[model samples]
Target: MLTAYLTHPDCERHQMGADHPECPERLAALRDHLLVKGLLDCMQEHEAPAASDEQLQRVHDRAWLLQLADQVPAEGYARLDADTLINPYTLRAARRAAGAAVRAVDLVLGGQAPNAFCAVRPPGHHAQRAQGAGFCFFNNAAVGVAHALAAHGLLRVALVDFDVHHGDGSEDIFAGDERVLLCSSYQQDLYPFRDSHPPAANVVLAPLAARSGGAAMREAVTQYWLPALARFAPELIVVSAGFDAHREDDMGNLGWSEADYRWLTEQVLAQAQASAGGRIVSCLEGGYALSALARSAAAHLRVLVEA
Candidate 1:
């Protein structure tokens, strides 16, 4: 089966501002590179549906949802935080961005696709259960993980986040849930400043020093993530695929390159094949540098498609 490519045109409409790093053009760059590399032809494409309130509530607080609805401006932008902003279409776009993750899970688990990648905008992983912050309104990967556990009856679901910054939101949601294991590697002392606290037993946090480069990341995965995943034997593997750690990207000081992304994806794919019937769902989280994001995402997708 081919990998599923899930996205929505509405994702392009949720712009924070002209100077925001999480711009709509990021999606266009990824799509353009995928097209140029002929990666799109190897996959099944689907337009993402808007996530219903029930689905969103699975990972986000009801009050937060209603607050976001109330904050949506008819024309201008409403700031959720110093970083997060909402415009007229922001809520709808956030729903579709998160919905892409849920649909990706269904597609992979239903055997319609070997795996799926969600190339949507207003990237998630920063929003926690009760609040939206750091340019994230809803935790997309967490929503999908919840769906896999509640809707699909999957007992063991693993979430792997390789974003430059720690997935505080995911960790917050799955902190004590033994059914889910979250393994993450992020730059030490980065944005949101969340490395101070100790993680739960099911949560594996690998903190890499600033400018650690790809070698450190590989070592972290081998020593920290792989062992935990092997012991957990997850029924489904979900990836919070963020490319901002690329050497060319200025989002963080990490020195990883496209090759690192390809290698990391291969490792995740091997784990999926071993324990999850090759079922994997990847959601975009970060990657501001357009050219590097495009190239790195294309590299990651090439592995997903086995191209």
Candidate 2:
């Protein structure tokens, strides 16, 4: 089966502002690089559908969903928090972004695709169960995990997050759910600082200090993430893939490179191959610097698309 590349044009319409880091151009940059690298040719492309309210409710509060729908402005931008903003198209974009993750899970689990990658916007990882923050209107990765567990009757799912910022939203949504194992790594004392403690026994966190290079990340993944993932023996693997840790990206202080992303993808692919029938659904999260984001994402996709 081919690797699936999922996205939606609506994702490009959810622009926060001119100077905002999480701009629509991020997706364009990634696609341009993947095209230039000939990576798109090897993959199957799919347009993401809008996630249903039922799927969204699996990971987010129903009240919060209503609040977001009511807050969508007819013309200008509405602020969700200090960093998150929504324009007229934000709701549709957020739905598509989240839908890409759900569709990715469906494709991988149904055997239509060996694996899948979602290249959408409004990076999720910080939004909590009842709140929208950190440029995320919906918790996309969490939505996918919930879909796998509740919709597909998956008993065990592993979520691996390598964003420079912690996946606090995922932690919040899956806090008491023992069916999901979350193995995450992030820069210490970064944005959305909620890594005080593991909210559940299934959550494993590795916080790296500022300026720590790829060596530290490798050690963390090998020691913490891999071990936890092996013990869980998940039926599906979900990746909260973020590229902002690249050295060229100033979004964070971590010193990662495109090669680091390649290595990380390889590791996740290995685990999936061993335990999950090579099923992985990766969703785009944080990655601000356009060039670095494109290069790192391409490196990661190359591994996913390789035969």
Candidate 3:
């Protein structure tokens, strides 16, 4: 089976404004880099579908979800937060982003693919069940986790977030859900500033200090995430794969490199091979610097595809 690459053009349509770090150019840069590196040739590609109301309701509140739809403007942008907004295409793009994660899960679980990566954006992980922030509109990976648990009757699913910021939104949705284990690593001083916080019983944390290097992240993950994952023995692994922690990306100060991303992907992929029949669904989260994002995502994809 091949690794699946999922993306949508609408993802590029959901932009904040000119020169924003999370600009629409991110998808283009990533895609072009993957193409240049020949990573795209190794995977089976698919266009992301729009997530239904029923699908998104698994992780988001119905009222807030509806409000997101109602807030879409005809030509101008609508505000969910100072950093998050909805242009004419933001809602559709958000649905596509969420839907890509769900589709990746379905493809992996249904035996059509061994693993998958979603390249859609309006990057998630900051959108809580009832609120949106940090440029996130919907908790994409959380939606997928909920789908695997609720729709596929999966008893154990691990959601691993290695973004530069804590996956507080994901934690908020799955805090009390025992069937899922959420593991997160983030720079403590970045935006959202959810550093050194206590996680739920099912949530494992590996908070890295500002300017901490990859060794620190590796140590934290080894000390916390790996053991919990071994104990839980998840049936599927869902990843919030973000690259902003890279030293080149100024989104945070973790100072990681592309090799660190490859190492992280290796850990997740190895665990999937051991306990999940190689079932994995990884979704794009935060990676700001275009060059770093492209290089890091390519490095991450090489592991999943070549595995």
**Top candidate (lDDT):** 1
Clashing pairs in 3: none
lDDT of each: 0.92, 0.91, 0.91
User: In candidate 2, where is summed lDDT lowest over 10 consecutive residues?
Assistant: 191-200
TM-score of each: 0.98, 0.98, 0.98
- Ranking of all predicted structures according to lDDT, beginning with the best and ending with the worst: 1, 2, 3
Candidate 2 residue-wise lDDT, 1-307, digit = tens:
7899999999999988889999989999999999998999999999999999999998899999999999999999999988888899999999999999999999999989999999998777787899888898899999999999988999999989999999898888887788999988999998877655787898999899999899999998999888898889999999999999999889899999998999999999988999999899999998999999999999999999983
Off by over 4 Å in 3: none
Model 1 vs truth, CA RMSD: 0.9
In model 3, the worst 10-residue window by lDDT is: 191-200
Error of 3 at 39 (Å): 0.8
Candidate 2's C-alpha runs over 4 A off are: none
lDDT of 2 at 267: 91
| Winner of 1 and 3 under lDDT | 1
